[model samples]
Target: MTWVVLTGRQNHLDQAATPHKVITNRDYLAHPALFRGQRPKVINLSNSYAYQSRGYYASLLASSRGHRVIPTVETMIDLSERKLYEHALPELELALNKCRKDLGGSFPAKAHVFFGIGPSKAWDRFAKLLFDWFRAPALEVSILDSGEWASIRKIGFCPLGRMSEEDKKRFLDAMDVYTAREWRDSKARTPARYTFATLVDPHEELPPSEIASLRHWARIAEKMGVEVEPITKKDLARLANYDALFIRETTTISNHTYRFARRAQQEGMPVIDDPLSMIRCTNKVYLNELMTANKVPVPPTVMIAGPADFELAAETLGFPLVLKIPDSSFSRGVKKCSTFAELKTLASEWMEESDLLIAQKFIPTDYDWRIGVLGGQPLFAIHYLMAKKHWQIVHHKASGKPDQGGIKTFTLKETPPHVVETAVKAARCIGDGLYGVDLKETKDGIFVIEVNDNPNLDHGCEDTGEKDEVWVRLTQWFLDRLERQGR
Candidate 1:
């Protein structure tokens, strides 16, 4: 991508030693030459980004033209309103309080951030975090130190001309470091047509996709001219740099994965397991109600809120029922009760953690069918057998380890059409993202258990049926969307 710097005046452009092109905002807005070629990464350094100002329009138009720009129009509007940015204060304040003594100066401290670089090394991490949240090229922040902790008082964009001589030198140096890359050179730009971010947590005990599987997907994508980069929670600030996002980690509404999905949608980037899917899939209570209202075939289930509802659930769903926490995953936070006393005890205890719980009639099947659906079609199918002699697919041990059941993979054609169709129906209710719909086949009928947003696609497991074809389809899903967006 090309780099262009837009400033308010010609003299302001003269101050920078950047190798990239620099022009006045007027020239960028009106010059036909600037508008004709490939869209560049715009560094909007105009004097003021106030609403409807020249600087504001520069960033706004850059976005509309498919150019990557710093301090996006969303960022500009966020800085304009305290209510818009206040939600980010708690996290930023926590970072500030961690290094309070290192802040040095006085009660009120002012810090300048130039492209995620702070005025001093001590403030670099905090500055990077602030930049990740706001995504502005330059920021001026005021921190007020209380007796117990420090709080953010104000945060706003810093114009290029308002800086002191020393700050200007630091700013220029930071800019040089930020842009001094081989890719920054037009002749040496990256060959890949698009960039993709795969979010993963190396430390997660049970990641949805194994590192090898992720590598396989990346290799396939790279061969097709898409660059795949693995990112973690710390890379949230760099999310906008990617053309698409694939969340390989387990998703929850309370975690960074949801934040990443939300940010990706806001930036108009294609993302798997979108925020709405995460919200709808992670909570069993929501899924239960959604499936019931849609007339989806699910085992008889009851939503238990308080102890008063336990008797009703037991009468309706029966004694040997499964109790589930709303946001549970990986067979955790699920309980099986055999009698009325056990049901009351378990439901009462689980109710403390969540306001609502799912009580479903126990369907004793040797194995549960896991139908993997992608874009409203069956991608793969598996028989998740019970763990040893246990009734659940995974049994938690007293030693704090889990004993998982064996899996039998089958192709789409080999699986029962009704099973695949029901899974697809359940998945579409969540959205067209990838899903793993668990179902149980009994004497009566096949019943939908739950849908997982972040289903396991581990190598040597779910890929056993289609092998490399699965990865190809997954990659194509992203590429097809990118092509539609004219990427």
Candidate 2:
């Protein structure tokens, strides 16, 4: 992916400050080369986005030419009228109220945001959410204090000339982070046809894939004429520069991973763990309903909304049942209750965070079968053993680190035919994307525990039996889609 920054005043931008190409707004609008060449991310920083203004037309023309532009024409129009942006007030106000204590007891009348970077760490989250909602190079926001809370009164574009020296420094620094200033020069390497963005979080305690495994995939992709670049949460604005997005972090609908997936989908870029899959697979309650409706084998489950429903759950599932939050992952939000008292206590604590909970009949197993399905077919199989003296495969400690049990990989032919067939059928309940179907093999039958959208594919664990072929097939799935899209 390439970047092109446009500005009304060329003097405001120093070309040497960053490696990305910076040109006058007129050049972007008048230059024939930009109109006919490869699509690049256009950063429109014109003085004003008024109707028929230079910035307005710049974004309009970029969209018409199939290039991604910031502060899109719709965004400009939304900011032009208060009624257009009223729907966003409640969300902004809620975020502000959540972080009011961190504001040092001072609520300013207004603030400036540069490339989603605010003045202090206290406003960092609010600024990021603001940028996620409205993508622009610079913004001037009016803060309204109503005694109880502060809300956004207005949102408008801030021109380059209106910025102070300090604002200019912050803007440039934020741009550096957005573009990945430390990224290696692609000019020195072989040019690829497709640019793949692998979204990851280095600090994640339990990442979906290890850093070494991600690097391995990158090496393989490079050989196949694809460029795989590692991106983080801060790189949401850079989604336009990629042909496809591969999420390598833990995905949750409430976090930046979902935002990244959604942004990629909006950009018409192929993405694994697509937004729909995330929405469906992240919620166990939804999965229970989906599997039951589709006739997929699953354990007896009950939805607990309050004490009234507890009796029904206790009667149907019996004692020693497992309780799960709607969006439990990695065995964190799941618990086992041996008696009714424990159930009540855990339910009371867990219900505070969620409106409903999932209670299932306990099906003890030495190991759970993980069937990796990609593009609607079986990709790999593994037996995820339970942690020592723990019922779950992962043992999360209070210190934030986690301990995991060993894994045993099996080839597709070696895995039981019933397990493979049942896993495939379960995965089909979700969209035809990358999925991991967890099943418990018992005397009665094979039952699907849950379908995971973003499954763990580490260096030596899940990739053991399939080895390099696993990566080859995964990369091919993305390439096939890109070719169909004619990109």
Candidate 3:
């Protein structure tokens, strides 16, 4: 069987003389096989018609599978003046020759022939020729309505259509997976280790126990597969090479640790035991405000803005209250007022020494809950017991003997559940990854008494038989996170 291709315009034939095979838009959509593998040839039958019918012919043939051909009709006018005659002629000829050779003989009379033809202007002949040279091939052509040529050119099919939607989506998904894997590998290739420069007061050398603890931490770091270097104040410049820092001694923002931490933060290193944390932790008033705002239960407290605020505070809070300076820690600069007269007298003394003080209702709690939080998670909890006959955990007796008021410790299991919950909640509210929370279980509920940014890890304290395991776990967690993030 022979196949024929058509282009340009469709012509009416005598149905009695030749059996006709019609390939219409409805026929193609219903039965695509009717047009597939067929060739089409187009002939211009109308004069003075614009090139509008090309779109219909293109759409029909593109939906089918075959070559397309268009016969050139030249006019005496200039090449630019003839439209369809100028454009599509060359490509149509090429398609016609191919289709004829492929079909093997005379054009198939019953074969599909699609054509889109319209009148052309003499001035547009050259431009039309250029477009015709690149016209896509189709199985059949048809004479479409006027103005259809422009629409066809706009929405016509290209030989270089993109892959199917499913294939494209699969390709993109694979690319994403590959990119993620590469990123993970790159991060794993470079591990991040921190260098620590801790200040040791040369005048006040570190105690033997403290030094031992430092060594212990170093060993823990090593076992956890992390690199750590400990340097002194004289070697402070070495901090520039580290990821984070820790200050061993009590220091102020004006001191060396603050400068180091600030510089590290500027260098894009995540600094813990940060200066701002230190400042906030050092100030009792700031802690109280933060705890209260976060809805963490706290003892009823009043600020002694000045000596005058003391009388009103005393009347509201009543006697047997706690008074403390804004920035004092370690139970220092704190006093308990048992009576109104005593409160007034202490307020006056404190007003002379400090600009602000806090008076809180004393809950008469015997033990305080201490919790160490890292990365917004509670690592451990302990109960610090007060000494006999002393209301505070720390005592400043002139005798200098081991103050009976020294603190004793207990494990999380021994600590009350409400205490742990409150401490954890308070620590999370603070939002700092590392901090210590002191909570007191009151008659009403557990109240956060204070938060310490840089909590102490004193040696020889009650181990609760899990110190080694806890430290190892914490160190490993930090190291794993650092490694995953590539510092």
Candidate 4:
């Protein structure tokens, strides 16, 4: 049976008053009687005096059809016609009085009424109130049309009304697939294959060697029976169909990684190197605080809030210090200051770029151990030896070059035991599923340089000369986790 729904006011022809034709047109267009013997049901859902004729018509129709007439009691008075704020005070008071009079009888738990004539500036104000009042879960109020109804069912409410039917349908389809995948039992049938995309620099495309390495890793996943799809940021949205994500590039909390991670979290997808982990790893100040709280050994460091604090930091931490931006990666914003003048000059430049800076005692070490920690265990450890002249391995000039002295791999067996232990402890302290810990072996002891949320797994670097044992172990580790998750 068809239903004629009249929202807001009704158009009356008997009176000389300007009629609300939109409501009448909607009711006429949705008429059910024209199709067959079935008569259309008319419901007058309005909260204004202008709907008096429509309410009367509904009562007449109900009496003729022998149906019960549902009349809504008027508890709210619309004051949009009143020009001044002072003029609306009395109508508001009258509404309050009506509410008090019918408090326990037939009045709803809450009365939400829209008080505007047209979709103008005044209507916008009333619309704001309508949204605020109708937002209550207990009160059932909405201004959704057919198109809006479908759109709301898909992505969510879009009050501005810009979504097309195609967009709505696509979103709905994705949501259906997402729900089905989530509810479906993996053990009952063959596991459904899912896709995932990772964010990578468009300019810094993965080299052929790196792509070969990824292919090798994919083969390893195939052997372990786990599916993986490595993609860049441009294609990340297409990965909405994926069950989980593994971001391989350096993604900061404030970058595209955060957006992708948030979306994945909302869609119930498992996102490794998630936003929380990225936040913890990207900020050097955060890591330092966490490490200190956990009693993890780290280099003595002082935070320089601005250039003015540099002298104080120098006095406190002493000279020959390391200056670094809190959220920089790949040794992008790190500098060594040997003298007080150099510290002041470097601090000024660093402060202009970033508000938070870390000044620490230089380890005076030539190499640092990069230990890959997966699921709270040290999967592999490699020494990142400094270039012959540069303090850090990532040389900016050679960054454009095909091959640079970025990382020199070494086995965990060759790394100092203390470094390995420190890396493992640091990773455990972070408590994330996947992370990388950079630790320096100083004369005193092993100190954590930093922990990275997204660490590089360059091709042939994880090779420990144990007959591809590391790759096999990593593949097995990932698969085991996925299997345990029942995916």
Candidate 5:
């Protein structure tokens, strides 16, 4: 289902144009079926800055359900809060100081600053809020809040809105030019097929097989009438132009990849590594809690805050424990502490980054069963062997050298039913996105090590026997999801 919410004054302005469900901020939360079923696309048209406004919750609800909502309630909230203005403050201060220097480092009584969302009514609203402050004669500040400044980072000053040029030329011309460039780029770029932009780190060259997997996807997309293009950090502003996003790069909270996922999701596009999925799969602490709560079998795990939690960890988990920083990839930050001294020393260092850490029992397995799951079903399975003489698939040593492992893929029908069942169960604890659930075949039973959001899909490894099928199924899922959204 699709929804277009306009401001109270502009209700039904374009209802005759599109068949999408039209709503106001008042009706967004009141409707029961608003967020359910056919992946509704809600375009909230209310000012998100007002703390209790309906537009604010509209973005939040839409995002929580993984729907495409605009003005990104998240982005709006970030803009309004001072914390999100970290970058903007510096620029604003520089401009203000420069202006004040001409005025003897002080402002006259009539000096008033204007911050806006757009060039019109929002500017008026923001101007009213600053009336209590001293205003200087012939000094008015204006900022605009239009769709042009779309990024949460670049748009740090976004929630303030935009001012009209008639208010007087200010220091925001550079920002406006930046937004103009983005606008033109988005408008000029058009996709002939169902566009699927894959986000990748362009600088880091991927393996041949991994690159081939993309070719496999490109081939499948061609047959399915979809276009697949590789995108990096530079193409983030144009994410909204695509129909779907298939990310093939490692994801982190502090990187542009996560922003791409967020942008795709907010634009109502079907994106893998959806922001929520990234959050859930990235952190081991969250995964451990989620798996245990759902009754999925995970290795005995403990959450350590500091040295105080170490003695109980030693008693409950015993020696030779596996230490993990909350979020890590490629087996980095994961250590095997065979002794208490090592655990203390390592925990101290890791704790500097995060207060909490994950300590799981050392379940020795020659190889870990990596089950590729998508849309809550098993797509493919692989036996990921540990690096030679190492306890994990990836061994990053103190010298910064790394040793990698081997992977043997198995067709869906060739895999064990138990492994598939266990993997699906574990991955479900996170979400129905594409995931790699790592499992161990131990003496007692199959224990889930952890779930990876971006599992290795190296061309010859995970896609070996079922290469075509894997790529085809992955691409088909997008078509199916798009169809569902339209329903």
Candidate 6:
């Protein structure tokens, strides 16, 4: 959660976290554990991506310890230069064309580009400003090439070369012109001491235990010397006021919860249901891919791409299989097709929205293990019994809220080691934030059904044995992050 800028030159304003010499400019590359131990969050804007560059190692070393890094190593090495030409060039071109339309056909031969080489948290906006500033063809925008001539341009740029005093002044002045006062690296400061926002929907019809969990969180956070307040979607602008945002409302890729998570992330606020966690946990198809890649046990599954694949899936997965729309949650948008006819009908319906449908072998079980994982550890475990006469915890067939079943809680010590370990491993593949890994204890073996980001953390349910310690453990993570981040 701490912020610092990594550059090949002398540090200027990135001060939230103490600046250290980049490997390229450093006398030596310190041990990776130095960063692994400190675990400070970093913004990688170092000019070099060559193998041993500080930018590359800073990202590699810090992220390996679960430290947060913006312009992640994946974005830095894989997506920045080489991938930019492939993925971003098209959009850049379109932005230029739009600019040209506004400029009456004469696209400027030169334009300022912010290379995400600073400590500004408004990198997304800066990327936008470049496109917005130049509506003309972007291909014509000439960056500084080999020629050396008298030039002074005020704009957001990564200074990798020795700049004359006048040029340096222009660059510094442009930093002020482009970056907002609060966003400027010079204005960066330690995060709020302890102001935390729990994103919730007051209007939502939450269960009593769910409501109790929130109250318990607030009470626990207060005792920890942290101020916790409930903020709704309407309080988006105020998200900046918090050191962390814990989302209690259900997370959907298309909903306000996603926006809150994203906003919190962009502002460098420690947040649960991190946009990556939410995105990875919400969809079944993606989960299948992730689980398979990691060799985690899963129900025999196949992604339905077309009519031909449907039959292949039915043949392989067999009849009475479970069909799920990628984004379905809480047992909704899931169907059991007993025959090919039913499978065809259900697949048609699901495929209308999702390009692909996931079909899995239906392994009957009395209950499923809902392992609550936080910060890459198992916090709590529960047995989610199926609704009467149904195959899942929430039975969609039986009217409002669907028929439900009893909940049984267990401490991590009480649960099977394999279940807890497998669940944690599965969730870690998605990124360590918070997750409820659903696993089926079957005759063959325990198999991960899916991982839920916004898993149920209701009072008296998930908090069965640990009680307030559940909230304590969860909140302590944020506190630690705030500490590590210099909050």
Q: What is the C-alpha lDDT of each candidate?
A: 0.84, 0.86, 0.52, 0.55, 0.66, 0.67
Comparing 3 with 4 on lDDT, the higher-scoring candidate is 4
lDDT per residue (tens digit) for residues 335-454 in model 1? 899999998888878878799988899899999999988888788888999999899998998998899999998988889999988899999899988899999988898899999999
Off by over 4 Å in 1: 1-61, 73-99, 102-109, 117-129, 142-190, 315-319, 483-487
Q: Hey, what RMSD does candidate 1 come out at?
A: 4.8
Candidate 6 lDDT for residue 356: 90
lDDT of 6 by residue, 255-372 (tens): 9899889988987889998999888888888899999999999999988987788899888998799998989778888888999999998888777788899899999989999998
TM-score of 1: 0.80
Q: What is the lDDT of candidate 5?
A: 0.66
Ranking by TM-score: 1, 2, 5, 6, 4, 3
TM-score of each: 0.80, 0.79, 0.55, 0.58, 0.63, 0.62
Q: Across residues 310-346, which tens digit of lDDT does each residue of candidate 4 receive?
A: 7788888887889989988777788889899998887
Q: Is candidate 1 or candidate 4 better by TM-score?
A: 1
Q: Put down candidate 5 lDDT per residue, 193-251, tens digits, no spaces.
A: 35577777645533212555676667566666666766667566446536799888888
Residue 49 displacement (Å), model 4: 38
Write down the TM-score for model 6: 0.62
**Tens-digit lDDT string for candidate 2 (1-487):** 5678898979978899777899988888897566464667788889889999888999999877767688789889988998998898788778767767888665788888877778888888788777877888888889888767787888888888888888888888887776662334455355456678989899998899988898788777767777678888887866766789999999999999998899899978889989999999999999999999999999999999998888888899999999999997999999999998899999999999999999999999999999999998999999999998888899887887788888888989899999999999999989889999999999999999999999998767788888888888888999999879766
RMSD in Å for candidate 4, one decimal?
16.7
Off by over 4 Å in 3: 1-194, 202-209, 399-410, 460-465, 477-481
**4 or 6, greater by lDDT:** 6
Model 6 CA lDDT for position 417: 99
Which 10-residue span in candidate 4 carries the lowest summed lDDT?
148-157
